[model samples]
Target: MPNIVEPKLISGNANLPLAKAVARRMSMHRGMSVGLVDARVERFNDAEIFVEVYENVRGEDMFIIQPTSRPANDNLMELLIIADALRRSSAARITAVIPYFGYARQDRRTKARTPISAKLVANLIHEAGIERVLTMDLHAAQIQGFFDIPVDNLYAAPIYALDILHHFKDVSDVMVVSPDVGGVTRARELATRINAPLAIVDKRRERAGEVAEMTVIGDVTGKRCIIVDDICDTAGTLCKAAEVLMSKGATEVHAYTTHGVLSGPAVERVSNSVLKSLVITDSIEPTAEIKACPNIRIVPTAPMFAQAILNIWNGTSVSSLFERETLGPIYEGMYSAA
Candidate 1:
């Protein structure tokens, strides 16, 4: 028998489909083991949460597959409780594979009284007995520092890059865009891999969930533009940026983001926007409205995620995953025209 027979990966109600997909890749079979109960969390008459883990998880290397996305509080609590339960049951090593880590945007406190909720969330996980974390495209990368345990910040860029290259053939007409100034580095990384020119969307924030239109830093007129972002929550920034680009005479607009934390009317907003299509990885399961819309395309990150899981299982260096950006330089010419 193989030394690593199998890691007993467990899933809560958060996003069963994504968890199942990940399981299918890791385990030859995708069925959940018996006795693993729903860690069923519910609200009381007074409105507090109750958690229950109905299984005996002794000496098991457990991986809890849950994305702390929308209903952020509840999901976050669910993860914490599940971890607590597993720890009590003597699980050898518990790994929290949260494809989407919420409160990640609050890594830096904007106001004097504001709290860095991301750090708090990490602390909760640590106290709950999570040995390690596996997540993708955190809103703020520094949130990893909040925890002392090993964290595998997987990259979905390579998957997106491959998809773009597969779907689109013409290179000259394509341009990758950063929806806001902050996401320029991520956008540049993806832009470099495709051998495409990069564009930046310069905008000011009038308030949260609202962006003040400023200017397009790079020329996108008549080019097939793909906006690369880490998270797309309300879709306000994305839709607004798409509109700004379209108004500036961009030929077409498409977006590839890692986490689709589509909260509220985000699906409706994206469907009705000027964007030709919005593609997101399965970090957060799509809402009902998102599935009903034809404009949204979901590309699978299963292959890369599966690879990362295998590498971690074998104790391999996953840093080579970022080779797309470091292996070759994409910008070759149009340098000395000035």
Candidate 2:
């Protein structure tokens, strides 16, 4: 038999709670006894980041969990430093598990003299000695191509599907609304899963940090609309889209996003908007203001990510984790009780 290597999980300071949860779930998997690797990540008085791996990681497969969310630059630097530390420590392979990849919005240049920051970040990771990347619901699917290393970009559709089924007894009354033309593909997937029709919000951006105007493309009359997207920033777009849906006779509006990058006035906007609820995964750590917002609901992505990590470690296909049948038990046990 060939030599078998067990994977070691490590985490940066970006989101310790999420990392801990993933580690706990991995430990629960049968025939797997993986544990979180000890590490110290701190900052100097002037904010220079430092990382030190406490235990032996030599010749071991290592997975580092870190989401580049708020303070994107700081968190991103931390991830890179941690990956560099692992590589220098002689880890067999290093996979950066970034659940919410920041700087992904700039995957392309809309005009001249602009940089593709996403590709730059990808190159940085590659240069940092990472062998692979595991992320979810990238803003643009093409961003995966930016990385030369193998990247597994997972989807939150299955998780949203399970949540929809749990909340809506009659799925026929539901409609999935893409907040913009770019998100139609994502919305369509969820719509197909819930057996609902699709709608789009045609909106134009007048300038940065604002949405000029929006128009509803399909009828949402008398339906419970769920607006789907990958990221929720200032939420100007989503809130505006929800208003359009409501004006078009939708009874209620709900929003589901994989990463809740609720910056600026997002929480305030969502709280005052017509949206009945806003659902987001724990891919990014919630701020105190986010917790205080009653309309915001957080769903755990730990079980799904835990399973994906196991599959990758076992050299098995991770795609099946996105299937509802494969995730039925996990979804039922976790969300059905909520």
Candidate number with greatest TM-score: 2
Model 1 CA deviation exceeding 4 Å by range: 1-5, 29-56, 323-338
**Tens digits of lDDT, candidate 2, 249-293:** 999999999999999999999999999999999999999999889
Ten residues in sequence with the least summed lDDT for candidate 1: 329-338
Per-residue alpha-carbon lDDT of model 1 for 256-286, expressed as tens digits?
Answer: 9888888888888998899999999888888
Q: In model 1, what lDDT does residue 329 have?
A: 26
lDDT of 2 at 155: 92
TM-scores for every candidate against the unseen true structure: 0.88, 0.97
- How many collisions between residues are there in candidate 1? 0
